[model samples]
Target: MSAANKGKSREKPMASLCAGAIAGGFESFATYPLESLKTRLQFGALEGGKPLTPLQALRETLNQGGTRALYAGCTAVVIGNAVKAGVRFTTYDQFKSLLKDDEGKLTAPRSMLAGLGAGMMEAIIAVTPSETIKTKMIDDSKRAQPRFHGMSDAVRTIVREEGISGVYRGLGPVILRQGANSAVRFSSYSTLKQLAQGSVVPGSQLPGWMTFGIGATAGVITVYSTMPFDVVKTRMQSLKARQEYRNSLHCAYRIFTEEGVLRFWKGTVPRLGRLILSGGIIFTVYEKTYPLFDSIF
Candidate 1:
């Protein structure tokens, strides 16, 4: 490519990332309560039906402290997800440039690869510190004189005590989750959208509502396919299990052996619910909004 074209390409991805961050931040804020609930459900034992239904989880969270407890780590989520989502969309699109067909049309396989690449990139760039802090905040196992008081405190503590390494505890499962999630999400969204459009090349686009529907469908697929990995990542990152589980593989093995194979699917219900809504919000907002950034920058 010419230098001029290369320079132009750089700017476009930057704008897409900016627009994506805005959309992601909005979606994260809107859906964070469900996110918190999902995190709770992922914790504790799940066998014998015991306790902790979704409603019970909600009650427990509120009763644990106050209404504010429900949004314990919302700040970390919003910050991490803004950058993660932005990078996901930007890298997917950027990688698509390399994977597209001669006619510049994206195939399902190519789109999946691009999305996987985007997911890996987001994990490295945005998932580690934010997720570590979020997990630590919500994890009440250390409720007795918590190690970190809040987000800023958590960051300082991790950095001071464990250095940079502490902030990236569950990176293995995080990468697995993000990579699988983006592959399924982008591939399914692209396929459904193209099937709806009845075209190989980009043609007339669907309405905003239909685009949302497609995105939700994709999110549902992503939730189930990657829930086990999500559970591992959450456990590995959360304060409670960080010491219990040695690593991602150890976490998975313990869950399968002790918690039962089905336990790996813990919290999938809330996650599906959350992701379906978030998927619609993300794709709809990003699609509707990014074009404006494209026009301007």
Candidate 2:
């Protein structure tokens, strides 16, 4: 390859990373409130029947703490999402490059494998503290003292009480859901984008809107496909204050036995909505910003 071509190729990953971070930041900001509500709906029910509807929860949260309550974990969310998007997009580019030969054709399964690998790595590195804070914030409504006042409080509390491992309470389910979610989400989005591009004019490509739509569709599929694990993870992490379950797998088994299989998909509706909006925004921003970054850098 020519030196210019190599330089352009090298720039793609960095450009994608920048674009992804911008997109992810916007996406996270937009959907964080719904995400907070979804977390509450999933884990806020008293052990004995009294689950609050999403609207009820939102109303109660506002009544008690005002609108600020809805964004309790926004800090963690922004940081975590920035890292997640950056890594996921950049790694995806790197993986695709590695998989493609000089002919530029990518093999089957390589995309999926790349997504899975990126997801697992991202989950392990980025999920723990942010998730811990998010769970604590969601559970704060039910507590007398509140587990955490803010992200800093949550992190300090986790480390102080249970040490570093405490912050990773549901790491297993996190990895499972995120890994599979990434694999399905990225692979589906890429495949759909490719298909969409094929139908466009010879010298033209699918619009950014098309990419967003495809990404949102893929996000919905990914979230729903791995939602059961998500439920388990939420339950496991949220129960740290309550100590209700031993671990993620135990939490899953307990929910299955006690609440039935349907329990595994609790709050799926809100989750689906959240993912669709978030995915659309993220993909749109990432796709639109990529060219700008390429031109600048």
Candidate 3:
């Protein structure tokens, strides 16, 4: 094939990553208030330190942090998710291509496996540091004595005080949570979209509104499936110079034993809301932009 034809053939691989990056950045910024709330509830006192109700959390976030504070680590999130979405979309597509059968048939299980790989890749490359900064900012704001003035200050302080490891404190749980999350989210969304389109292949596109609704449904599924891991991840990451659990497994065991099995579901309300909206926005943007990028590339 000629250069033009070759570029055309590779359109998806070439542009999918870039398209995803753009969409991911915008989605994260657009939906950050929910994320801040999610993170706050995830670490706040379940029984102490003033009730952490959803409305109360929202009020506090706005009052204490201001509108700007609502988007505490927006830069980290946008940049991180740009990389995360880019890597995940590109990697997942590659994996799915490889997993397709001789007749170009891709099964749901294979799609899930690809999503697993893509999630893990993005977790390692992006989620760890992004989460570190984000969690820190929110956790700090809750205190009368805030830690850092801004993202740059937070970065410098964290690095100076705790070294780089501070940024990766809860990596284990992050990996597990994200890996499972992406797998379930992508597989379910794809399956739902396929069913709606009445096909096993990727051609028939759903209406934009339908896609958003389905994405919200998928997000609900993801939130419930991963809430336990998310709670543990937050606890592990949010320890404030006071050592909490020893590690991820310890964190899980402690939360289960000390707080009861039900305790692991902390932050469910905000998390559910955030993810529901997030899933709809992110996937809707991705699906709509994907073809545009493919054609342009």
Candidate 4:
């Protein structure tokens, strides 16, 4: 491609990133309640056992903490997701462009590799504080008298109690889960989209809804397949002031041995549901908004 063409291609990824970030932020806001419930379910109460059904948990959280509680750590959620989505989308596009030049065509496996790289890179930077605050927010909602008041307090307390390292407690599992999750997600979405594009009648394209459906299926599969890692990630990060887990692997083993293997998949239902909803919103907004931005720019 000529320099002008290369510049245009570069601009596309940045536009995709901005569009993906906006979509991710909006989706996170819309699904905060489900996310809050999913986190509580995963981390469990300060005690143990399933104290609340998903609906009961939602009601209790709302009654006790009000609407604001649903949105706890939303700042971190948006920022983290924005960074994750932006990077993932932008990097995926860049990688695809590189692959096209190298191989003369795009393929599903190549997209998977791109997604894996992007996901791992973003997960390391984005998962730590985002998840730390999320756990704290969920923990706070369960208490009569909350521990940390809000996002700032949670950050302050984590740093004070456990230092900066504490905030990144579950970095290991996060990378494992999210990296695989992103790989499966984008790769599957792209592969499916490519298939759909070909299947459409001449002079007609696959609709945005079709793209969303494909993306949501990929998101659910990715989320559920890696959910055990997520359970471990949540537990490791949500430890109380004095509480500690030996490590991610140790935590997984303990949960398997003590709690049973089923414990590893705890909160899978709500998580799958959350991912579907969030994924739908994300892809829909991203696909729709990118065209608008492209036209504007």
Count of backbone clashes for each model? 0, 0, 0, 0
Per-residue C-alpha lDDT of model 3 across residues 1-297, encoded as one tens digit per residue: 001111113326767697778778888887788888878777655325754787888887888868877777778888888888888888877777677676665578987898899889898899988888878776776676787788889889888988999988789888998899989998888777767766334444667788889889989999999888888878877745237777788878877787778777777887788788888888888877887777787
Poorly placed runs, candidate 2 (over 4 Å): 1-11, 44-47, 239-242
lDDT of 3 at 34: 84
lDDT of 1 at 7: 19
lDDT of 2 by residue, 156-263 (tens): 877897888877878888889889988888778767776776778854545767777987898788877988978887887774534677666777777888778877
Question: What 10-residue stretch in candidate 1 is worst by lDDT?
Answer: 1-10
Better of 1 and 4 by TM-score: 1
**TM-score of every candidate relative to the true structure:** 0.91, 0.90, 0.90, 0.89
Worst 10 residues of 2 by lDDT: 1-10
Q: Each candidate's lDDT (Cα)?
A: 0.80, 0.75, 0.77, 0.74
In terms of lDDT, the best-performing candidate is 1
Query: What's the true lDDT of residue 269 in model 1?
Result: 76
Quickly count the clashes in candidate 3: 0
Would you list the rank order by lDDT, best first?
A: 1, 3, 2, 4
lDDT of 4 by residue, 3-102 (tens): 1122214437667678878887888877777787888777664366665678877787788888887777788788888877777777766776776544
